[model samples]
Target: MKLARFTEQGRTRIGKIEGDRIVDLSAITGDNHSMRRLLNHYRDWLPALQAATGPMFALSGVTLEAPIADPQKFLGIGMNYRQHAEEARQAGIPIPESQLWFNKQVSCITGPFAGVVKPAVSDKVDYEIELGVVIGQRCRHVKAADAADVIAGYLIVNDVSARDWLQKSPTFTLGKSFDTHGPIGPWLTTADEIADPQDLQMSLYVNGERRQHWRTSDMIHTLYQQIEYLSTVMTLEPGDILATGTPSGIGAPTGRFLQVGDVMRLEIDGLGFIENPVIADCAQEVMP
Candidate 1:
């Protein structure tokens, strides 16, 4: 089932998507005020939510939002895709010895259809379309074999990056965590909704020109392996997200970085599609 979080009037609410309408689930558990809170009761409410029905509202005209606005952690893997890693190597980045991880600040999170502000400080903005794995329960030291049990579902993630800052700074977090950089969701798709997360086709297009196209089968390390690796370091809490890296065809390698008005469209099979417009920084005021 496709569960979406959106705002109507002035309040944020959760809903179940069916056909071209949204079945309101705001009153579902009576305890989940936000998607972050809903994850705490995801298992218990799954059955009820799937079987529920309410006032059907048109899917359009609602203010859609990131599935979970306030997750405890927003981590991402780097160069996990075979072709992506190859591109990195060709671009002078060393081959990874293990799953490389980076932090994408929660503040960067934005709705899937929102505009991504091209920071005034950088001219080399880039896009990385990745499958976002949303954790369902808190766990540590989980084995890859048991990782599926802890997963809630999947979503799309546009891991936007600022190349100059990324390359100049010693760490990847700052460049990757710019506000509005992490565009996620249309909704969260439960794991049961997906038969196998490892064989899906994913693609990205810029202004209608297809740039990246690959399958989850092309990932060097499986999502379960990434789960096991991440869980061992820190507890994987409900609503925690993992952007499992991106495929090749990034703009920086071709010297074709984004300009102020470019649009990026990303999609993953069984998940959803996201289209984000790029705007100049001056068009978006920086928060003090």
Candidate 2:
């Protein structure tokens, strides 16, 4: 089942994405207001709801937004893709020996297809196409064998970065925490629907030119391994997200960089695509 969060009036609501329409999940499961709770207690309700198809709005009628709003934590892993890690090496950065983890301030999250504002202060904005893992339950020190069980589903993530700040600062916090940088969703596909996450094909296209293409099979650390490694350090709660690192072909590594009006479309098999227009913020507002 494809899940989404959309803006209706001035408020945000959760829904189930069906053929060209959205079934407001919040409308059916009265009093249960969030996708997180629905995933936890009413996991079985999806099929029944799918079959009970009622009035659904056309796909183009509503605006698409980030599927998971207000997740407890947004954890991101760097250099989890061998090819991407190699790209980091070519830039004179050492390949990490362990899963390199960091926090994306939740506020950076943006709707799918939303415009990504290239910060005015940094002219070196870059993009990273990654597979996002959404956890279903409270996971503490889970083993690799138990990892998949804790997963709710997957989504596409663009881990937008600011190269200059990242290279000059002691940490990556400022470079990665720009508002509207993290473009997620299009849809959040449930785990059971995806037979094997490891074998799926993924790619990114910039202005219709294929830039990065690879399979999840090439990942240096598999999704389950990422789960086990991160869970040992912190509890993976319902709605907690982990973005397994991007593949190669990012701009900075090749001496090419984004300019105003560039469009990036990233997609993974089973999970849908997210397309965003890049706009320059020449005013240089300090990141919030």
Candidate 3:
């Protein structure tokens, strides 16, 4: 089932996307729980909940929000694609053999179609298209072979970066965690729906120009390995998010960067597209 969150009458609710409408789970079960809460107990409630139904609202009319609200951990992998790593290397930056990971604080979460605020303090805003993995089950020290079992679903993610700030720190948090920078979710397509995570296609466009075009099959460390590698260091819990790295063709590689009013469109085969328009942030407005 496609799980999502939407706002109706100023209230947010977890829903199941049916066609172009959202079936309100709260109204069906009469419980005020978010998607994360429902996902925790999904095994018991899902079967019955799938059978029950309530008012279905037209999806076009309801405001779509990030499908998962406030994920426990929002992790991102950098340079996971060999080609992407090579691009960085060509830019005089060394690429790491192992996965280089970073955290995107939950505070940066934004809707798929939300406007991206280009911070005034930095002039190097950029866009990255990535596949987002949503954990369904908790697993620690998970084996690469068994990693797929712990996955719940997938979503399209745009990992917007402030290139100037990113280079200043070894860690990417400061550049990647800007508010409204992490635009994820049109909806989470359940694992069962996607036959193979590595078989999907990814495409990214900046202002209608195709920038990043690659296949997940090209990932240096596939999803399974990424999960296993991460689990070895920390517990992977339900509602945790992993943004598999982007492919080559980022602005940094081409000496191109985002400007105010730029539109970025990111899409994966099963996971729907997320389009965000760049806007000036609080600081940008004060420029002389």
Candidate 4:
């Protein structure tokens, strides 16, 4: 089932998507309508969600919010795609021998259709389209073979970057964690619905022009290996999002950066798409 978090009539709720209509799950969840709660006890709620008969809302009437609004961790893998690694190399970054993970702070999370700010401090905004994996259960030291068991579903992630800040830190936290930089969702397409996560076709378009297009098959390290590598170090919890990696065709190599009017649309086969517009950051508060 496609599960989503949305707002209608000024109240936010969770629901299941059904052919342009949403079957509200709020009634079943009662006061505990957070996506994290649903993911934590997904097994227990699955049956009820499958048989839910709550009120349906027209998809256009409600605004979809980030599916997992406040995940404990929002992480990303860098250069996992062979071609993207080559592009990164062209931009003076070395391809890692193993998974190169970074944190895209949870606060950077934003709704799929929200506006991404082009911070006044920098002008080198760019986009990386990636497959986002949502963890369903908490586990540590998970084996590659058992990785699939911990997965709840998948969604689209636009790993927006500020290239200037990116070069200042090897950790990439600063560049990748800009507010509204992480645009994920449309909804989570449960793992059971996806036959092979590694074979999906994904792409990114900037203002109707295709900028990045590649398949998950191009990944240098598989998602399972990434999970194994990460879990070996720390616990993976429900509602944690893993941006598997981005493919080639990011703007950094070519010197093209996002402007105030550009819109980024990311899509993955079976997972749906998310489009976000770029807007100027007008906040007057000074960090200094």
Best by lDDT: 4
Rank by lDDT, highest first: 4, 1, 3, 2
Tell me each candidate's TM-score. Answer: 0.96, 0.92, 0.95, 0.97
User: Each candidate's lDDT (Cα)?
Assistant: 0.89, 0.83, 0.87, 0.92
For model 2, how does the per-residue alpha-carbon lDDT over 1-288 read when each residue is reduced to its tens digit? 888877666556667888778877655666444667666664667666566464466768788888876788888888878888888898889998888888888898998989999887888988888889999888799999989999999999999988897877656877888888889998778898899998888889889998889988888989999999988888889888888888888898776777789999999998878999998675745767
- Candidate 1 overall lDDT versus native: 0.89
lDDT of prediction 3: 0.87
Which regions of candidate 3 are displaced past 4 Å? 28-33, 284-288
Per-residue lDDT for 1-288 in model 4, tens only? Answer: 999999999889999999989999987787566898999778987899999977999999999999999899999999999998988887778888878899999889999999999999888999999999999999999999999999999999989999999989889999999999999999999999999999999989999999998999999888888899999999999999999999999998888899999998999999999999999897796877
For model 1, how does the per-residue alpha-carbon lDDT over 113-216 read when each residue is reduced to its tens digit? Answer: 99999999888899999999999998999999999999999999999999998987667988899989999998999899999999999999999999989989
Model 4 accuracy (lDDT, Cα): 0.92
Clashes of each: 0, 0, 1, 0
Question: Which candidate number maximizes TM-score?
Answer: 4
Regarding lDDT, does 2 or 4 come out ahead? Answer: 4
